[model samples]
Target: MHVLVLGAAAGGGFPQWNCNCPNCHRARRGSVHHWPRTQSSIALSADGKRWLLCNASPDIRAQLHANPALWPSELRGSGIHGVLLVDAQIDHVTGLLSLREGCPLDVWCTPNVHSDLTSGFPLFPMLDHWGGLRWQPIELSDERTVTEFAIPFLTDISLTAFALHSNAPPYSPRRGTPSCGDNLGLFIVNRQTGQSLCYAPGLGQPTPLAMRFLAAADVVMVDGTLWTDDEMQTLGVGSATGQQMGHLALDGPNGMMALLDPLPKRTRRIVTHINNTNPILDDQSQAASALKAARIDIAYDGMQLTL
Candidate 1:
């Protein structure tokens, strides 16, 4: 299986249009320490010819254009064969609008996430007007037995999805009422090579269940949303902490770094879905340097992994 980092930044993406955060400022001025990224999303391909997009970020159009591997091969055909969604957040789901053209896409997500999109956001219903949006519902595991799924075209790739602790979308009826399928993390395995990968862009905590999934993967790509829990508050960006927003901060004793530092040395750890306010965007910052010292990578657009 092949994994491609189509976008690495969190919601508003690096160098968000309106804000003048230090990181964004430096990027706007062409700082070498910075490389602008699209919103979070990735594409997985077993054959390198057809891909299964993870999330449809608002920036999917530009992201696809930037990666030649995803470019269309025929007059009206595209390399993307299907889509898999991990949650119902705006940054992750809105790109379906841009993708409504051409053939209908086979979209996979938990039933609750599908409900949120169909009722709360109504993106699913809107897309249906043009026809061809196939909903593939998935379920969380009871833990006694593992649950897994596969994209027919990507036959060699199998994915095991486990519940992740995250808040439901504000517009969702289940908001503030945690449920099993609100969010999820995927453990992708290459059946042919026995290589595995874990992808979770939103993680509120390092729950035992999450750690189990992480322990089994050769590569771990997860949230790097905030430098500190208080980043947004201190930057005057917002009052909500990373925890409140269902993201794991990168600092603090209980932060992401602490959560991942003890993983097996051979695992390839990567940071993605990073908030623009995070100082790690500056390669020279202590935050970025810390990641470097640990041999953890900061994901960038177009980064690829062949498993």
Candidate 2:
């Protein structure tokens, strides 16, 4: 399985156009230590000809341009076989609009995420006027049973949706009940190779279920939203800590470091969906040193890993 990192930054991306935070400032100035990134997304290929996109990030156009493998000669109309959405967030699904009109793209997503897209945005209606799109809903259960779905041209891949704790509180509007639903972390395993990849971007912390998935993965690309809980707050970039923003803090107990320490040596761990404020983007930063020492990689745009 060949996996390509399309964009590694979290929502808003590194060096967000309007923000004047120190990290953004340094990125704009072209400082070597601070690497600029786009929104989070990834592409996976079994034969390296046909591709399956993990998420249709807002930066999909640029991401496709950077890696032509995603745009195969077989591309007609919309230009890809299918897209797998991890959640219903704007950053993940908004880029579906960029697909070519009149081309029906197969979009695989959970029921809640599909509902959110079909109702939350008017763009779906507008896009339908051009040409209707097909949605394949994947029903998720708390049990870690492997669900298999076939990608056109490519072989079937086993996907397991693991339940995760939402960052939002029970009273929070974002926290929908069982009838509506919460976000999910996806575990995709290539049937041909038996190699699996785990992705969980918007998570409050690593659940035992998540760890179980990670333990079985050949390549694990977990969220690296913030170095510390108060990283953004201390930097005066945001009022809420990283944990409060729906992601795990990278340090301290129940953090990324502690979770990763016990991971099997064969499991290749890489951090993705990184926030701009996180100093892990800086190679010289102590945070970066710690990650490297533990054999965990900080994902960057255009980075590719073969599992």
Candidate 3:
């Protein structure tokens, strides 16, 4: 199994165009310690012949250019087989528009997300003119497994969705209630080696069910959207807490750091979907030191893991 980190920064990417926070300021000046990053996205491939994108970031074009493995092999032929969306967030699903190049593509998501894309955003009908969109639903079971879904173009790998706490995207009218299929963390297992990976770039809290799924994985990549609950408000970036925006902070008494501390040491714990305002973006910051001490890795673009 090969998992490639196409982009690790959260929504707007590091050094967003309009903002100039301290971290973003340093990154724009090309500081050695603060490198720029794209929005959150990953590519999963078992044999390197075919790739499945976890989420289509707005930076998809740049990300695809940076990674040659996803390039076209023949005339109008692409190595990318399908896309699996974890949520309907704009940053996560906006890149689908870039993919509409008269080539058929398969998209997998939960029923709720599918509805939002079709009715709320109306992105589905718009993409139909280019090529075709084959929407596949990834259903969850009472056993805590997303069953009956596999990469149609790849073998020896199975996909599952673990429920997480998340709200509907801000644009959706049906934003009042959250459901099991509203948002999800993905589990991709290599049936041949029993090596598995769990990805949760949008997290709320460490529920028992979420913990159990994380405990069972060999590699875990989770949300690192904010270093503290009040990071955005403190930096004057936004008024909402990290949780209020559908992300769990990395520090504090009930933050991700403490929740992850109890997991098995053997699991490789990496943090992705980092917000630019987070102090952890600065390697010299105390937050970075603390993260290093806790044996957690901050994911960066182009990082690769093989199992």
Instruction: Give per-candidate clash totals.
Output: 0, 0, 0
lDDT of 2 by residue, 1-307 (tens): 7788999998888877778787888889999999889999988777787677888888888888888786657455323567888776667767888874534677777766666676665445657765656787776655555555556655656677765665433333455343324567778887877888887776666667777888888888888989999988888878987756677888887798788888899988899999888889888889999999989999999999776
Candidate 2, residue 165: Cα displacement in angstroms equals 2.1
Q: After superposition, how far is residue 160 of candidate 2 from its true place, in Å?
A: 2.1
Sorted on lDDT, highest at the top, how do the candidates line up?
Answer: 1, 3, 2
- Residue pairs that clash (backbone atoms under 3 angstroms), model 1: none
The candidate that achieves the highest TM-score relative to the unseen native structure: 1
Please give the distance, in angstroms, between residue 118's alpha carbon in candidate 3 and its true position after superposition: 0.5
lDDT of 2: 0.76
lDDT of 3 by residue, 1-307 (tens): 8899999999999988888999999999989889789999999998997999999999999999999998998898676889989999999999999999934789999898899999988778889898767898888644544464687776888877877886779887756577778789887798999998889888787777788789999989999999999998998879998878878899988998988898898989999999999888999999999999999999999999997
**lDDT values for all models:** 0.90, 0.76, 0.87
TM-score of 1: 0.98
C-alpha RMSD between model 3 and the true structure: 1.3
Candidate 3: where is the Cα deviation over 4 Å?
143-148
lDDT of 1 at 210: 89
Could you tell which candidate, 1 or 3, scores higher by lDDT?
1
Residue 244 miss distance in model 1 (angstroms): 0.7
The parts of candidate 2 lying over 4 Å away from their true place are 72-79, 100-102, 144-146, 167-173, 176-181
Q: Give the per-residue lDDT of model 1 (tens digit) for 1-307.
A: 8899999999999989887988999999999998998899999998888999999999999998998888989888788999999999999999999998944789999999999998999988888788757999887765687888888999888899999998888788987886888999999999999999999888878788889989889999999999899999999988998877888898888988889998999999999998899998999999899989888899999899999
